[model samples]
Target: MPVNWRLKLKGFGPFDTQLDWSMSAGSAKVAIYAGNGQGKSTISRLFRLVENPQIPFPSSLITTGSAKGKFSFTVGNGSADLGHVEVDSSTGVDNQLDYLFHVFNSDYVRDNLQSRSYSPSGDIEGYIVGKSNIDLSNERQSLEDVKRKGIDARSALSKELEESKQELVSLGASRVKEFQEINVDFLMNKTVKEDCYADKIEQLKAVDELPDDAQAPDKLHLDDSYLDLDQLASLLERPYSKANFAEAFLEKVRRDAEFIEAGMRIQDGDRCPFCGRRYDEESRLLISQYDSYLKDQEATVIAALKGKQAQLSRLIDDYGRLEAQMLRGSSSYGEMRRGFDDLAKVEFPVLATTADFTTVVNAVIDEIATKNEDITLCVSSEAVGRLRDALGTCQSQLRDANKLIDELAFNLGKSKSRKTTLRKDACAELGKRIRREHREAFEEIASLRSKYRLLEEELKNKEAQSKRSKKDAVARLMANLLKGVFGNRYTFSEADFSICFKGETLGKSADSVLSDGEKAALAFCFYVASTWELINEEEDKNKLFFVIDDPISSMDFNYVYSIMQVIKNLQDTFELSRTRVLLLTHNVAFFNMVMGTKTLNEAWMLDEGKVTEVKNELLAPYAAHLRAINQVANGAAPSHTTGNSIRQILETLMHFEDPSLGTLGDYLESDYGGRLNEVAYLHLICNDQSHGTRTFGYAQPPMDDSTIRRACNAVIEHIRDRYPGQLVTAGVEPSENNSSS
Candidate 1:
């Protein structure tokens, strides 16, 4: 599963208009050893593009003063020569290098080595730096099994569905092309298959063509919000009394009541209003009877009867409107009868008919008019009950009609676009007809499709479960790795995903207490542990690539061996075809340690923009120190770890001269050449930088670039003056750090 890759990049950081590199197939393990500022990190950035070409590989990565820069990557036997990625143009790449290369760089450190923040209630939530988890291999395996089954089911279903479709076509069924031509809304948002192939097929088959000659529905429309008639009946039939008078005298007086009443009001000082003469006592007393009749309950009765008359008039107009609405509904029903045969014949309610309502209302009006003329007449409760009963019967009938109308309305909605709807229905019916003719093929297709859908759902659920399990597994590994590296000083909690120092959680204050080397070790342990995500034996058959960039840059000697052991374990665990670790580093000591002697053939030195396969001796820490000193003497600014290289050069030279001297400061006692005070200060500078003891930025400021260059030049001169033969023997090609002198 080893992949062959060729990369050509132009104008990309410290690379020029020409930077081409290739990895041969079967060359799984490789190294790019370089000094710190020589741009070896660019290799990691290039590796990232294979996974995601659109990651912010911006113009800033291009060297300055270039119009554009392009890179081409050939993956998997160079047959897949993915097109150029133009940083300025934003052009994309297409490649088949699918080997999962887990990259560990500053970017990865920023993303995955999570920072845990605490809440107000003392609960630690993450983005967590540490993990709490269990081994989830079983869960992961189960998911893999489910995924395989789901994929297989989907494939089988696809084959069967195609076969069924062809069978239907042979059996004279319409092609789904026609279904696609129709507007999607016609199916009310259903898929073409569901609309044409499934439930609707049966309904359409039962009802072949549109029905003609159907009867009108039993009731066209219902107005459940009808008025109450019981109150009206009570008002109409209530009893009233007139003045106490003889019947014969009442008849005459009732007609002349108004005239008689006016005469009585004018009877001031016994003067008559009827004639120009004063009224006698007998006439005055007789006219007083008219006033009594007008003021009595009989007057109230007449006013009440008139009110009832006005209500009846308004009822007549309302009844007419109700009739018009009913007529319209009946006409609509008759029209609908021409299509939908399920509609029942309608016999509209009398309450809905304005004529029937008017008849009942008019009868009450005429009766009330009679009572107004004769208030002495008896109030007939029987007649009132009879009229009320007729109105109540109409109200009940209207309600019954409303029920039938609702059912009819629902059916009519379906048949509104009768011709077009029936045609579509008939098409579905044709599908049903074809299925009946070729039942075997159709059933097989349906069965497979159903199973496929079920399998897909199961696969998704299992995947979710497995993803959670994998995180727990990563946490389990992280806890073991941290404890292994730092011992009891740093403990990782699987329960809360917290990294604690001496039983206390390390938050933002961790940097103040822990050394830079300790922090680097924690991050590296986590990075090595997180590679478990790619450990899928069942699904991923291809090899995995681990591109680790500068894993131990800032580490001290105490923690360096532990870091080397973790990387070694990582190599041993995912061995041979399973993994390919391409480690890029500036630390010659680290490179030699990790590669050992067996992997020297895979070691390559990268300088400027060129790569050359080098021997094991080329990466010696002694030679590396000499190079750093030379670069500084030539006025190059020193890198963060350059002080360590400087210190190693002096310490190795002085010890080679006489192993009894423990420190560079002891050189003063030996009467070495050059400034003795300057040498003592240089010794102090090297020790302070090489050992990260004082708080960062708390000690004296860093030596200026000029002072560092002069100090480095002086040390090189002092080395030449004392031990000139050692540099000639050690050579420019590096060798491992030697302590057996």
Candidate 2:
């Protein structure tokens, strides 16, 4: 499916220059027609290059100095195209698939894993002993069991680790808070007591209301002097009233005279310092008059004494109000004393409720918290180790399980291999027996092949009488072939071509009795049948590709005509539409013959290590020769038909149905026309002219440079014109032979 007939190389093989070649796709088949030494076989090797790129060029394929080539092809459906692949003289990798893959896929059996010699015995025994297939359905149950246990362990470990961590964190935070509380508790009473005492001092100073002569009380707003007098008056109550009043009155009068003197000093026509404005003359006069009146009034002191008496009553009232204000201190005395006492006190009595406080409780809480923290640290540090240990234990258990599984798997594998080996060994033993039997079969086949070859050789060697015997041998081989076709037991009369099986020949046919078609079919069947037989015992499943190279090479034209049918039948029988077939030949006649009858498109033609175009009839030389014969027969001259060249006669003889020699005569009538026909006919000769045919003057050295050049040009130009881009480049040089114009 990956091959297409239309695929071809541009410049490849013996066609040293570029050439666009085409062929068939699917059932179209492929054909290639080219002069000898033009790299036809080189093209065949191209497939080998594609499937494999590095096929060594045989010395024979090299035309002149150059072997470098380029190949191109359409891989599948013509859409998936693999473009040109070039091979210069030096272009090749050491490890090439074309050469190495086959070496790797060779018949030698090797160990797949180690790539070394291996025997199935050990593996077979292991499989039988393990009995791995006994209860495959129960594997799910086993897996479930394993899974359940794994889950259990995982859950337990997860919960244990998670809770342990949380407990430790909580304990750590509690410990931090406890330490803070203890420190604060220790300082709380002292701080509170200090503050309480400081407050008490303030309260005591408030009650005392210390006089102004003393240092001012921190908490009092009174002036120091006023406070001092007020305190002295309080202390000097009752009998000390006169002195108190004298001191109080004297201080008051002194303060009043100072105030008056400060106010009396006034400048005439100047602003009064106290009121911030100029004193008018009238105002100044009024002030002077008042002063004089005051001086005069000083004589009338009795009147002033009466006024002073009234002021004395008001002073006494004020004195009584001050006394009342000082007396208010008596109310706060108790609070001041209590506060002072509290500050001076040594220790406060413990409240009865405090007696229940226990160090044991604190110690218990602390110990619990410490243990929790230790547990957390321990879990964090040791969890992985514990888990590892647990995992190691689990793995140990799993190892045991795996051992059981391995034992079963090994046993099963061994058993499977053993069963296959047994079958293969039996098949091999049978094949050996069969091969021995095949000795006779092969001998018979060889004999028939020899007989046919002798007939062909006789026809080739004794040219004069060869014609009669060749026809006779052809008939004889045909008759003999009927024996194989009919399976042995038959009396050959002109009437009966049928045969029946007899004796050991029931399943086998002696070579003497096989026809050309039967021989070809037999060879085909042997290869294909043997392949199937081999596949029967192939223990390990392996893909195989069967290649039949020129299966009908020894057969006649009639048999050659049937080769395509045989191939088709085999392809269908083997389901080998997928199998690759690489048919190589230079027989255009045979290729055309097959193409005339059957459609085979997957066929590919090789040209100069590249896939190019080739006709189906060319696959068999006999078929191509037949085409040439028909051409000559159809174009032969009736007058000189008997005197014509043997090649022409052969062409005439092959035109079984062309009664009118019309086509052959048209070709044989003229000299240049015959020469042209001959050139065209060369593409049909599949015979390996390694031993040239003298009748065709093949032994003569190839034409001189000019002649060969003229021929090369004609062919090259014709090919190029037909194929447009296709060309055949032949590197020819002057030889010993002289050139004639």
Candidate 3:
């Protein structure tokens, strides 16, 4: 129960200057009156902000050109500071203020009003109370987790089983069913009790035979000794005694051939090519020496050596061709090819060299007495033996290679069976365990889901029961309040836990319906009734504060009176001495009605950035003006705008109490017997001066303030004398300085 005892504002909203409001002791109800735009609504918005402190103070609340402002409220009768907020800086109040104050304004009515259909006895299925049921939520989440885990387990088991079957297929199992039906433990633990075909595999690996396509080394025939080339050179020497003379003449001829070939034709009288001189006796002598040297027997022996070198080159070329063909066919015989290559590389070069062949042939020709003597050359026994030994090595290597290939093929065949057996055993073990665990997990998940569903159903039932009880109570209170406000014009019934209006339910015309005013009235009745119900149910009723702003706005005059009665009833129900209420309005009649009906402990008038305490007792606006005019005539200083004030008072009196009286001028001319012309004249002066314009036919002579004040007094006297009991006067006790008209 935090009550606002005082409020201090600086540069806030429309109040650009500092403003303060204080509630006197024992003041449980206060009435504040302000014309439009006088900070009345600003105060209401501030109260809402204080209740909901999470809302930031509006930037527009700061006065123009002001960077910052602050507001502080004193709470309760002890004047403790409840909150102090700087504009544009802080959120005003906290949630501790909730339910302590309730404000209702035109916006609240518009936001909450709606056409709703209801049935009181219907099940309250969607009602929510306080926080959610945590136990129910936790149960649901736990069930979901179980289901997720079960799905994962099932998927994993299925995957493992499929992979195991695939692995068995890769190991050459013809069909999965053959191994799937076998006992996993027995198959894996059993040893190889049957023959593994080891002896046959070993025999295959050890057997060796050369391939049918294997070739033998070619035969070689070498002579018993190499020929001596130097002996052949002696046999070719000239037998003449003039050998040196012939040798010198050959040397001279050899030098002259170079000069003759350079550019000179070798004619009988040709010039030497190198020196550009005619050939002389020395050049002719050199040419004759070449002719004689060409007839020597040494040329024949040199030609025989060249022919033998050509024969050796042909033998080497034939050997190379044969060796390449042999190696190409040795792909399946590595050892055989290596042996042949080694033998060929070492021995073939000796017979291939041209120089070696030439020396051997020359020596052989020199030893033979005749050129036609058959010279047979045969290979040495040792060289032939080496060739035979290399062929034997190749044949042995072929046998070893054949044995190794057989062994690999045999082992590969046996491994296929062993791998298939292992895969079957693994698939059986893993698949069996996975299926068992997956079944258990799925069963647990199913059981949990079923239990969770039951618990949720029970929780919903309990919530429904609690909601129904609360709704029914509110419906009953609303119906009762509606009866007090509308009487028998409309029937009030509770349906779907809401108040409904009915004219036909009471046997009236089918088309009879509630007007807009009636609807608003009913809505207002519901709101106020529900609020009272809450207040009554509150633990500390005395702590409650109600703020209602312009409750009867846009309401019919009759309904406004009814609203006043309703408020009066509420005051009596909750004693004003104990409960605090703040009523603010721009409606003068409604404000006066409330003030007149209830005992307001304090009153305030707000205008032009200022708040002033009002000492006058509760009175209608017309009566208040009349009282003010009476004061002005009694030597009190006149209000600056007393002219317009008096005019408004007379108009209000005519409109409400005497409708036939018409305008103020008509009322003065008719009801007062034409004796109150000066009062009417004063009214016209007030209207013209207040509006800053001259009304038509209001060009009478001007009167001073004293004369006008006197005329206001005379009009009050005439109203009292003429209509003695028609007007309602201010309720203040009579005093020397204060008087009611």
User: What TM-score does candidate 1 get on C-alpha atoms?
Assistant: 0.49
For residues 639-669, could you state the per-residue lDDT of candidate 1 as single tens digits?
7666777778877767777788767777545
lDDT values for all models: 0.60, 0.35, 0.51
Give the CA lDDT, 0 to 100, for residue 351 in model 3: 23
Give the alpha carbon lDDT tens digit for every residue of 1-741 in model 2.
334433334334456556565543454233344323345545555544433444464344344555454454332345654333344434542222111111111111122111321111111111111123333335444545545654554454344434423422332322333223222112222222112323333433332332223221121111212122222222212121111224454344334543544566554436666777877788787556544533442212322323333433343344344334333332222222222222223221111121122221223233323323222121121222332343344335434433433433343334433333333333323223333433444344344445555554543343332122222222243344344333344322212212223433211233455554454444443333323322321221123333334445467765565556655554455444343344444445554554555534443444333444443333444323322322233332212111122344234433543445545444344432324454543322312122245335656454333432333344333333333321111112123342332
Question: Candidate 1: what lDDT?
Answer: 0.60
Runs in model 3 deviating more than 4 A are 1-4, 52-69, 79-99, 114-474, 491-493, 496-520, 529-543, 569-578, 599-601, 620-646, 649-741
TM-score of 3: 0.40
TM-score order, best first, reads 1, 3, 2
User: Cα miss at 340, model 1 (Å)?
Assistant: 23
* Location of the lowest summed lDDT over 10 successive residues in candidate 1: 116-125
Give the distance in Å from residue 271's predicted Cα in candidate 1 to where it truly belongs: 59
Candidate 3's residue-wise lDDT over 629-701, tens digit each?
Answer: 6656665556555777677766765676568775666766664434566454666666675776767744755
Predicted structure 2: clash tally: 61
Give the poorly placed runs of model 2, Cα more than 4 Å off.
Answer: 1-13, 22-38, 46-60, 70-74, 78-551, 577-584, 599-741
